[model samples]
Target chain A: MTRVRIDLFASLDGYASTTGGTSDNPMGEDWGRLTAAYAATRTFHERVLGDTSGTGTTGIDDSYVAAHFDGIGAEIMGAAMFGLHAFPDDPDWKGWWGDRPPFGTPVYVLTHTAPRPPIPMQGGTTFHFRNTAVEDVLAEATEAAGGLDVRVGGGVSTARAFLRAGLVDHLHVMIAPILLGRGTRLWDDLRGLDLTHKVTTEVAESGTIHVTFTR
Target chain B: MTRVRIDLFASLDGYASTTGGTSDNPMGEDWGRLTAAYAATRTFHERVLGDTSGTGTTGIDDSYVAAHFDGIGAEIMGAAMFGLHAFPDDPDWKGWWGDRPPFGTPVYVLTHTAPRPPIPMQGGTTFHFRNTAVEDVLAEATEAAGGLDVRVGGGVSTARAFLRAGLVDHLHVMIAPILLGRGTRLWDDLRGLDLTHKVTTEVAESGTIHVTFTR
Candidate 1:
């Protein structure tokens, strides 16, 4: 069975994403602060950032970061997450992930501006646009995953959509020990979520709490 | 020198207080769920609930719960937290705590409807209503503490008031592994709080994360 997975970084205040996204500051300074611990991990350095010097942390946080990149055959993300809104007019513009994107698999991008030809980048990564329902897109992603896990790369709203639809199998959230007062909160409509899934928590050496919800 | 300390129970969504508070359910069902871990602690059984049988948890959570009952000389809470809103007109209302309240020290109640003579209940628990500013009330509570730490007991708004005034020295929030969806959030308008105070996080055995902001 192909499991639908998602990983989120939120502040203790429950903010998942903030505004003010530019080409330089893709996800805002608050996102940087919330994901600082994850970025400090060796897995994040080797995987997402392409830094293989092995100068990053190697503790509990690194384990989670390593697991995040493991067995993810396909990815489903929102148009906002793909920076479509940022580079709306530019047809040639790809996502924040450069020409050689880290995701070495088919990435389904949810957008109303679908039907656009799939952009197959280097390293076996292909960006497929979809305007259909989340369930339909998820079906394709699950099939495209080829028995592996389908990672739901998010921008808060997209993650909540998948969660509200009860599609996520495993949800991991890293809670940063800070307060980001204003942002799109992650837990606004997710009530009694623990009742549906088994919840577990671990304290990382970087003072971040890793909470996982597994169905 | 008295330190202003506070302990709050919040959902992973940062909800501190929920609505639907009545005479029976003083703080609502969400509050109960958020504080289930704390309530299961041995110290909470003896101190707050007054359960002498000692059939409670004695783990990492119990240590924090035990510390909550230590060196608390006086407590400052809001009128709503004292259940004044539930019984606004009842002058005979002695608050939620029975004749023998858990707090053995002076309890300052912040209310615009103050000047009501101090009501001294059994077990040395005095309810003093104050219509003055938070700083003034905190000063009075600090003086009343005599040498021990003063606790800024909360209803979210009350705690935020003290925190906004930069009067809180230690703030420990128990983040329950649940999402309440709707309630009065705890971390609103508390931007960059971690910059002012040292933030530390620890995961309890009950899947709850205890985050402390110590200045």
Candidate 2:
């Protein structure tokens, strides 16, 4: 069976965004610090996004991002990531990714309100709206992936629902060195579940740590 | 002005707690790694709680807890921390701490619904309920601290309200080793804020990193 995974970058004080929908300064340099593992998979990122424009030094902590994308076949995200909440009527809030999203596979978005049809991007990525239980999206994602693994992209609430269902397998987290005094937190109701995982930690030059766990 | 700082220990995959309110696993060698930190702080912790007999480690992550409580004169949190959402009518929701909460100073809870009066803990920790803006609470907390700082302990939304007001001066976060695949995420709509900070990072023996950022 393919293991489902969730990979994310977060601050030391535990906020994903500080400004509701405008987390301008939440983690700041911490995210830059956390993506150190990017170097290991720089080519992959560039290949998927088709962006070959910059020459910045890869940070040390981006490895988790690189490593997690290794064999991801599909993605599942929350409506918030696609900016759906902001534009309830436009139906054009495909995603922040412009015409082509970074993922090169199918992406499913869990939502309460239904909107336009799936939008096709330049790459193979296709964004589909899912109006069902989290498990339904996961089932679709798993089947669409064939034997390949699925990546549960974030937007706090969506991820929580999945964890509550006991679906995630391997989780990789990148901790940045900054804090957003106030913002959305990651583990609001996680205390009830009995989660067990083994941690492997590595530090990057930018002062971020790449931590991974297996369920 | 007394600057306000926020610190938290959350799982790397973004969960502060499982659904049950217990912290998601810290993902190292159980409590074996933080024995020293626990021992060093155990006396103060027990004395504050009037529990002379609770000697051995509580088996909780002491370093994470210690780093959380290191420097602060006052603390502010939300009603969620009082455990009211899950246990509405129960008087036992005075918080995870029994007659003596860990915070040894005044702790203000920002809320609009719960109608409980302030309860003073053994260690001078007084829980005050205020249905006011976070900025007001911070102002009051700063004043109450004399010259010490006020810490904004949280539920995600409460923290975001403070960060949105630009009241936080420092944020310290601990990224643990697990992921709540879905729930409330830490970052949601935080974009485009100009923030600069200095980051210092180190890994504890428990595989959790001690990452701090001063803005």
What are the per-model C-alpha RMSD values against the true structure? Answer: 1.5, 9.8
lDDT (Cα, 0-100) at B203 in candidate 2 = 64
What DockQ class does candidate 1 belong to?
high
Computed on C-alphas against the true complex, the DockQ of each candidate is 0.90, 0.14
lDDT digits (tens) for residues B1-215 of candidate 1 = 78999999888887887877667776677878888898888888888877889889999899998888789889999998786487876778878788888889999999887878899988889999999999999889989999999998887899999898888999999888888888887888899879999998998888888999998
Question: Per-residue alpha-carbon lDDT of model 1 for A1-215, expressed as tens digits?
Answer: 88999999888888888777667887777778888999898998898878899889999999998999999989999998886488766667687688888899999999887778899999889999899899999999999999999999997889999999999999999888888887888888789789999999999999988999999
Q: Model 1, B31: alpha-carbon shift in Å?
A: 2.9
Collision count for each candidate, in order: 0, 59
Q: Give the TM-score of candidate 2.
A: 0.54
lDDT of 2 by residue, B76-193 (tens): 9887775536555666567666776777889888777545778887867888878887777888888888888888887666776776677777766565444444434554443322
Docking class of 2: incorrect
